[model samples]
Target: MASRGLKFVNIQEHSDARGNMRIVEVDGGLPFVPVRSFIISDVPTGKTRAGHAVSCDELLIVAQGSCLITARTAAGLEEHRLTPATGAVHLGPGTWLMLSEFEPGTILVTYASERYAETRFFEDYVEMDR
Candidate 1:
């Protein structure tokens, strides 16, 4: 499994007698400087989200619980299970992403390189292929 434009980044966790914390910054584990950020949570079971591709890059982090992420690119399809310890997945432009099989109370945080724009979204996979 080569993930083409997608990259898995390992997050560094700092632990002490108090607790643990993971920091994300540009040029660190985060590949891009995010201009937008969003959170997805409280999803009902047996449901999916994000069946589209964007022109700008994105990074997804599983803040709590777990979920399955499926992405399609020019190379092929790639699947990944996202968990707190699993770090984050960096999605390049034009990569189709679908998130599903989320555990109860799963919280996913996403960072985007660009602001939201309807014109930058490709809802159909066929359109992305072109």
Candidate 2:
């Protein structure tokens, strides 16, 4: 929830006889403009991906399939199930994330406020709780 500064963005979908569409923009609800973007797809069953804490915020969107994202921070830990309907989950700085229990053909898209920089990321979860 917003209490932890974590937000679940609800995307408005427009559907008709033709197809369905959803529009997301910087000014819509995102706190910051994304400078870098990436996608995770075809994750094997029982596999997991862990990410370190970074200086910038992140927006994770489950474009396809489904997965559970657990994020830990100084405040505590929060888990979110992202789907196409739920849209995206926003994590602020100093948050460590772990992705697991991915369904077949699951596709996760991530957006970052800052450009990719290895030096800006830390894998030490303990340090992030400081």
Judging by lDDT against the true structure, name the best candidate.
1
lDDT of 2: 0.76
Instruction: Estimate, for each residue in 93-127, the C-alpha lDDT of model 1 and write its tens digit.
Output: 88888899999999999999898873276675553
Q: Model-by-model lDDT, in order? A: 0.83, 0.76
Structural similarity to truth (TM-score) of each candidate? 0.87, 0.84
- RMSD after CA superposition, every candidate: 3.9, 3.8
| Residue lDDT tens for model 2, 62-115 | 888899887776567778777887888888877777789898889888888888
TM-score of 1: 0.87
Q: Model 2 off-target regions past 4 Å?
A: 1-5, 127-130
Which portions of model 1 show Cα errors greater than 4 Å? Answer: 1-4, 127-130
For model 1 the local lDDT of residue 82 reads 96
